[model samples]
Target: MKVAADHRSGNSFLDFLLSFVADCSKFQSGYVALIGKPNVGKSTLLNGIIGQKLSIVTAKPQTTRHRILGICSGPNYQMILYDTPGVITKQMHKLDELMMKSVRSATINSDCLLLIADICHPPEQVLGTLDEGAVNLIKSKPTLLVLNKKDKVKQSEIQKKQEWYEKNSGMDEVIPVSAKFGLGIEEVKQWLVSKLPLGPAYYPRDIVSEHQERFFVSEIFREKIFQLYREEIPYCSQVNVVRYVEREAPAKDFIEIEILVEKESQKAILLGKEGKALKTLATAARLDIEDFVDRKCYLEIKVKVKEDWRKNEELLEHFGYSGKIASASL
Candidate 1:
């Protein structure tokens, strides 16, 4: 993806200041959860901030289902960002309820909250007057309001939304950003570093996320489903990595994944006429998975019907939504 080049560069005075700050005793580290309604560019913002894509992105809403942790560490600070599922006002299924549970857990566990809103659309049209859960969380935490999609909106419009958030939401600060074009990202980093509490690094500086390789592999397939299919196909489907194995020397890694659907008709839709659609999806997903693992992969994909799996607690747990966000150092 195209992004802005780093503006911080070689200047004797700036270098001296950075070195001085790095050597200071006041270092900062903590978790900051990114919370907002669906399709508000939360995943895109996280990818831009962390300088990598840990969470999947699509035009479709509710693409992210779990709490994904993206770590950003500098010489004197480490900010662990949690990209959570969008907070839905109405829980339509057991899966929706589980996703909301993740939002609540991330909000409660984080040291600071980053609430994002799409500035290209009206607040009521994009975020829809804050939900009670969101309102309570904002009231309780040190929150930052982020106006995303600034590249698509005018400065006057952005300012209007910023003022509206300041008045209605309990946000401590407002920062306008364009996640796609990398506008105002430096300001966001500086603000986060200032707000973070003084503490040691929670994760190793080299690592970018906490999830396993298999988890990302499944997510890649799920993202392909979202990108290729339409209507209820993406919503009623889930990807599970049933088997994953690594090999040495002259051998390729092996991965077996199952695409679970709620009905037989959905399976047919995914498979497509003459299995052309499934082949296309598998090729795209395999390429991404290979790039992620840095190895050639032999992938096996199958479609299965698991009626009402979203509402089944057992199935949900098996799919890795354990009804609790795993504990992380804040």
Candidate 2:
């Protein structure tokens, strides 16, 4: 018997040719916006789907303040996932409006939307229902009802929430997933791919996100703030990377970061007794920064009291939260 060297057979040359042909076939690519209320695991879900830490995840709400784009490419599909800030219930400061604007911008022109809801809450809770802003955003999009944190809820509760969303919300599909544990993520990816139109890859296959290293570096420092602080401290704080200097081989990279707070008391709190707190925070952040840049990092963190910085338009823009709501309007 003669062995066949064809594409369908176990032939390396023919297999490579067939794979190339498949790559050149019609590919699905589009932007998907992940919108939800605070602590709904939007960041976690995005990181889980993309298989990287593109968005910072903390136990606190509103950790994501801008529109973050994370790209995930497969053999035949490329998903540009937009992880926006959580919907703000009350626009307290200019920063709040800016965050909401990000959500709006992310929703506009998106190929698909994932409204992630926390299923662990009871149906009567606000978490059970989508906010007006979210509802309006979902009305005209190919939306998917993603009930995240499925691991925290019972099967009966999951069914109830899914049924409620299916009836009350006009989502095309309802998926239950635990972003932390990676359950039902494959289904989420499949649904996103199904909704994407046939097109060429939007970004390079190896690229995970469009943000530069400084953006992620700032987020890492902010994540530490949220992790270490309590009450209104984290919410009132913002991290700014003033100088990020990279040196050649055999030289350690230096990063100078400033943590801005609204009051001197907050600044003192951030510095802690004899700057011990800041030192601990810097050490923790440096370890992660080293891992991210794959180099030895010397991180310098300072606390500054920028009184009412959240309300200052110039400062907000400097902080990169210039409210661009009008630009997002359709």
Candidate 3:
């Protein structure tokens, strides 16, 4: 029994593939990278464009560690939207340095930059681009300044945000948007389409992302972990999807995922008394993945300790962090 990797055995395969690749083309559509400070709605913007919660969102800062590449496919185009980790403002650990490098690299690799700034933040707070002197780099790029959460503030106040942004950042093109409410998103789309050059598609038409199913499943679980433990355990943890099997005989699918923490204390924090927390996290994550895949997903979870993989270079590479496009490209 031979198998096919490129060819799908089911109907709608070719149509999906062609559509996926066709969407990535600039003659049709193109890619854009959203970069800005944490909690500024980058993930919200990506989800808003793709109309799905592909990237996890939370109120806590530094919620995103990896670059979420979400492809939005339309009739004649697609946008390979990348949601990167927010740029670190203060001096951070080695891991922080690598993540910030990834964000900066995304800024350069992208065709257009949508620098998000929350309208709800202080009027004097630095919004859009980071104030750490990376401002000029973004200013030189074909950029759009998105004032997200406009609905959270008064319309007149949002205009004040626009004026404040223009005076501070030299950003002439500031567009107010409410990502949660689906306002001003189409304008952002039109703005992005205008900036990208016409070219052949970069990916197949049917594909929504370059990552496989396991990556997304693990990410969805990670979101639950982050939401639950947050400063207690999230940044010090990672999700490893060990096994994913599609069963034709049983007409079912199962996934084995591992959650790694940095220490025994952290492990305790995750499991809780009689493993209640772990059970809760797994249940929520399992439901989310099941919905995403539209199947009954059997999830196996194990909690382990890796002791600071974030700072260890070899371990980071082993975990597939061989310079995510940010470090590799720039």
Q: For model 3, how does the per-residue alpha-carbon lDDT over 108-191 read when each residue is reduced to its tens digit?
A: 778778888878888644543465446666767788889899988888898887888877766648899999889999998888
Candidate achieving higher lDDT, 1 or 3: 1
Model 3 residue 140 CA deviation (Å) reads 2.6
Q: What does the lDDT come to for candidate 1?
A: 0.84
State the local distance difference test value for candidate 3. Answer: 0.78
Candidate 1 positional error at 118, Å: 0.9
Question: What's the lDDT for candidate 2?
Answer: 0.83
Q: Evaluate residue 196 in candidate 2 and report its C-alpha lDDT on the 0 to 100 scale.
A: 92
Best by lDDT: 1
Residue-level lDDT tens digits of model 2 in 1-330: 122445446677666666655765778899999988889999999999999788999999888897888999998899999998887678899888878877877888698899888888654333334466656767777888899999997898888888887787667888999999999999999999998987778788889988778888888888888998899998998888788899986889988888889998998888899999989899888999889989998887768788898888767776667532111100
Q: What TM value does model 3 have?
A: 0.85
Q: lDDT per model, in order?
A: 0.84, 0.83, 0.78
Candidate 2 matches the true fold with a TM-score of 0.87
Error of 3 at 51 (Å): 1.9
Q: Tell me the lDDT of model 3 at 184.
A: 96
Question: Which segments of model 3 are wrong by more than 4 Å?
Answer: 1-28, 124-133, 249-251, 323-330
After superposition on all CA atoms, how large is the RMSD of candidate 1?
A: 8.6
